[model samples]
Target: MSERKYQPTWDSIVTHPTPKWFRDAKFGIYTHWGPYSVPAWGENTTWYSYAMYREADENNNPAYHHHLREYGHPSEHGYTEFLPEFTGEKFDADEWAEIFAGSGAKFAGPCAIHHDGYALWDSKVNHRNSMNFGPGRNFVAEQEKAFRAKGLKFATTFHHAFNWFWFPVWNKEMDCGKPENQGPGKFYPKFHEEHAMPDKEYHEWWLGQTKEIIDQYAPDLIWFDFGVFSLMEKYRKEFMSYYYSKEAEWNKEVIVTFKEIAVGQMLGNKSTQFTFAPGTGIMDYEKGKLNNLTDNMWITDTTIDSRSGWGYVRESGYKSPERLIHNLVDRVSKNGSLLLNVGPRPDGSIPEEAQYCLNEMGKWLE
Candidate 1:
């Protein structure tokens, strides 16, 4: 492998340096879509699986009440039920590529696997994936080919690190995460208390999935979600080195992004800290922005639908194109890039509102 340049050490890994392509390409687009899109419910639709199983919180989560009214009950109609509904019948990979390219995005891709344990790729590691169940589509592979054909650098986002705590499997009464319900050996899912630290096997599967994504897709960028902060230092080091090693073979610079400074129970783990030391990779702000410009490369992932969730619902409160343009300009002015997110419907159609916004942005950019 052309002499692996990075060892699994922060000191060694930090030297791998941010790529100029990322710095110059000031805008990108990625998606938060999957079976969760089927329900098209919840304020934070991406977390519907988790919220559907819980009692109404202090804020009165709409997904919980919505589940009761629409889907019957989490005990009977769980997240798994949505898999069949996520047929993606209208999912046109080439059409999606055209829409993203029209948005003036430089890089684009899928969320791949969000906090939902369900994967969109044909996964050998997780049996409960898109190919075996759900829409029966290899979303990552489809998008990679189409996006690259459209002259867009492909990126994939992984939020599955928190899949360990995503579902309350310990409840016992719910069929959602029950051992038998998950099918044959329970499919490498974590069965732990919300606050518990996952065991060694779960951590191994986490790394295995990351490697699978790396080897299979060879994406230009990999943006990790906040769940990564909960990972142990060794897994973090290993994945970074493993991804960086691809630089020589791919003949293109690759980027791995980490969130800035997450400490304490932000990941719902109490009495311990899991902080990501920044400056090791590209810094990312999730639904946040910086007040001042900086020399180091940074990115902000904000949703295109201004109201509601990252995953699509029936109705979207799309940001006006002018607002999106200004936000992009502001981030670019501050030496950071904007990774705008779009939540396509379960049928794989980009919302007309989102399409108009992107079209307007594209025209303005032109």
Candidate 2:
């Protein structure tokens, strides 16, 4: 596919200190905590919602099936059942914040929403939210309060844009070529035709969801996942306006993250394009270190896992603490930040491997 084309018009008008907090902070944690993580079952839970619907062989090595048996099929022991298990009772926000601080993370926040369309905060538009359904707690709100109390800037990452297009990949209801006459559960429906105002509804609903997060939690940063390219120019402007207005009200700067492919358009001749431009980040290259950091500041988000999976699964092995410390130092020396990920279990507890890594990171930072 050809590269996406975007022309942004609002950078100087909506500027923030670029080489400030992000440059000095040096490290931040990207916590992929969600209802899916509750299962703590397989290597594929993070991608489970998408990988499950495809046949066992088709979805690039199906791990969801293994997840199903490990936890039970979604039909019998449905994913929803794990919600009650995510009591988050053992999750001390302050303690986590302290760990982040000790680990030298200048900021920390949870995945406010992922491709499954669930919100971590108290979202009025989406009933399937952490505050109402899963843990029955305002996870984002609580985290923000705790991080702020510890003097760390709060951030929120949203993966919902991918959910719209990505969710359909697994859901039989929306898959193309399915017969309309077929019964509901057997095959997917003609979602575009059946639903009235699908675009308007989803776009509005997504916007409303962001509004609620900004209003309630006041995130210092709002990171968007893939599919932002799909949003129309008008909607993008509207979204930027909303974000810039809110940032001004808070009298603080913010950083928005995007994948490397999407960064150029988002940052078009303007600061509002991204908190830290995409491609500005770095990662370890097998041959050697990634050289020539972008003229603009960037970040490299990596995991300790040597495997492809984001979370802990059987046989998952972590990189040596020495390697991770060196990687962090390499990025920092090149004027970049390392946004590390920690895949927590479903019950809101950090896995032992993750904790050990963070503890080691703390010692290195100290």
Q: Which predicted model would earn the best lDDT? A: 1
lDDT at position 338, candidate 2:
77
lDDT of 2 by residue, 1-366 (tens): 012111133443234345367657877886876666655444656676556544465356455566555655544444455567667777778877877777777888887888777677777777768766756788888889999999988988777765555433234342332354222332222254322233776677677888788888888766666556555545555555566556556776665665534445654643344322333222222213357565566566776665545654445777777888998889777766677777766666676777788889889788
Off by over 4 Å in 2: 1-8, 11-19, 41-44, 67-78, 168-190, 193-198, 262-289, 312-315
Model 1: worst 10 consecutive residues (lDDT sum): 267-276
What lDDT does each candidate get?
0.83, 0.63
lDDT of 1 by residue, 1-366 (tens): 237788888888888888888877899999988888888775678988888888775367767887888878788887777777788899999999999999889999999888877788998987778898877789999999999999999999988888888788777677755767653445336456657887788888788888999999899899888777667888888888889988888888999886755556674445354344556788888877889978887888899987758999776688889999999999988889999999998888889999999999999999
Which portions of model 1 show Cα errors greater than 4 Å? 57-59, 183-190, 265-275
Q: In model 2, what lDDT does residue 269 have?
A: 43
- Alpha-carbon deviation at 334 in model 2, angstroms: 2.0
Q: For candidate 2, give the lDDT of residue 205.
A: 67
* Global Cα lDDT for candidate 1: 0.83
RMSD of each: 2.3, 7.0
